[model samples]
Target: MTGAPLLRVRDLNVRIPTPGGELHAVRGVNFDLNPGEVLGLVGESGSGKSVTLRALLRLHRPPIVMSGEVEYGGQNLLKMSEARLRSVRGSQISMIFQEPMSALNPVLTVGEQIGENLREHTALRGRAAQDRAAELLDLTGIPSPRARLADYPHQFSGGMRQRAMIAIALASEPRLLLADEPTTALDVTIQDQILRLLLRLRDELGMGLILVTHDLGVVAQTCDRVAVMYGGRLVETAGVHELFRAPKHAYTLGLLQSLPGAGAQRQPLQPIPGGPPNLRALPPGCPFAPRCAHVTDECRAAEPPLREVAPGRLSACIHFDELPALRTELQEVHA
Candidate 1:
């Protein structure tokens, strides 16, 4: 049986009104996630990765306006009423944020936080909710689940608190999971463990996952597909292996080349020059043009929409076809 996509985002735009002006945090982003599939939304800071994810959950506050379609299970979330959206948030879709300390309520015990969703979304009461909460904690590999249920967020280590957050996110058996840099503040070993836990949960629950991160290595290891963003726009989208092996967009290539082990001789890291353009006043042409090495006059005249450069691979660069091929210089550099 062919299941419909769990979540679909199309031409999404989000703007936050500031005293200075409206800051466009996300623009024209599009992607879909099928059940049991992980789609990585990757980019540098302020590249709209987190904004896109928050838009999916309808988590933005007032003065933060959002537009476009966020379809989930045939329903357009953008059009859902506040009450209906609340029903969807914890039960149908959930988010595990970057910082567990901030995300979790300090006053509530870990068990209470996990059980809060069960009580709100399900008919479970008292002991039943408590039992289910402990089960979730155990499922997330928290030892001594029963005893730890009484422990507050401050009592646990950083890694354990993150696991608690994941446990809460999974409490409602959400069909779509949004993890926004879920492993960001953890140690490498802890990060790997968290990634593995997420992958295992996805496989077992058959839930769609959107992993927002700056770590390309995490994307390569955990995602089936990836969308690369820059300056509030999607620069490229491709299957995991295809993107890593043959990144077509110049920005994409630069990202891959900038990876820790891209070349053996460890040539001076070639960072994409310049900071992200100010969202309040974007350039008339391609936002990446100023920083792109291969920019041409034509590229500075108009913005380029993401177009299919190959099967399942899309790039927004106008001169994507003429971009130089990236050779594996590891061997040569080493010799």
Candidate 2:
């Protein structure tokens, strides 16, 4: 499973329309997913983590433009026929959406939704499908799955709905799972349980997972690698341990500094100053320059491409060398 990449995305760009203008939601994002690998896409809201992953499944609707290579199984998914794309989705690659209630059909029962996936992708049908749905629910640690199959989405708690979503995503026994904040609305204990459940499922099924979330703690607990996203672009990427130990990009450092647990006792949380840039009108140069403490003339002059600063590590900052000093300062300030 680890010999070759299961999915490779290169130079991916996604644009969406708004009343104001076309917003560049994702800009030249690139990543490789190997079987059994858990990669965390860490970024604040609207940082394009979800948008970038959604492109792999062609989940966006019209007025949306996506370009570049999404190579899976020797084919470019971005260029595949819609019918072919549909065949791949769920069957080979499944998504556990952000919000369970919205992702699960409100009108459908939990069993029906899970059974639908089994019917569409697998050979299961009728009684077998119904029984499998209950088993799937059980697999996800849902209690009394047989009794709950008839329950609607609204009848379940946030955590239960998320588990149901995971069970449905697993129906096809997909090789890849794109989980978009599967634990977003769940409490801490439930979130931990869901994360563990996913890890267990991944090990059992040997599927690669791209977990899109803003939580560094979650990334630390669940991912093998972590990609840090900023204004529609990757600011840095590293092994999960390497990233948390020593981040290279300013944005990555800022995110760590903002973590309450990352600071000393009595240290105030040092939230990253300013807001993310508006995608519709991104800076002509580095998108994060406006909010960066180390911005320079060169930074505002042009955008920096994500380049390797070390083996197995990439950063998209013009002044990345200065980041260590700045990181220390921020740590001291928070301390």
lDDT of 2 at 5: 94
Local accuracy by lDDT, each model: 0.87, 0.88
Q: Considering only N, C-alpha and C atoms within 3 Å, which residue pairs clash in candidate 2?
A: none
Question: What would the TM-scores of all predictions be?
Answer: 0.94, 0.94
C-alpha positional error of residue 92 in candidate 2 after TM-score superposition, expressed in Å: 0.8
Write candidate 2's Cα lDDT for 1-335 as tens digits.
34769999999999988889889999999889888999999899999999998988988888799999999999999999999998999999999999988889999999999998999999999999999999999999999999999999999999999999999999999999999999897889999999999999999998999999998778878899999999988889888777777788888988887776544444577888899999998887898888888888998999999999988999998877776632333233222
**Residue pairs whose backbone atoms clash in candidate 1:** none
Q: Which ten residues in a row have the lowest lDDT in candidate 1?
A: 326-335
Tell me model 2's lDDT, rounded to 2 decimals. Answer: 0.88
> How well is each residue in 16-124 modelled by candidate 1, as lDDT tens digits?
9999998999998888788889999988898999988899878898878999999987888888999999999989899999899999999999988988899988898
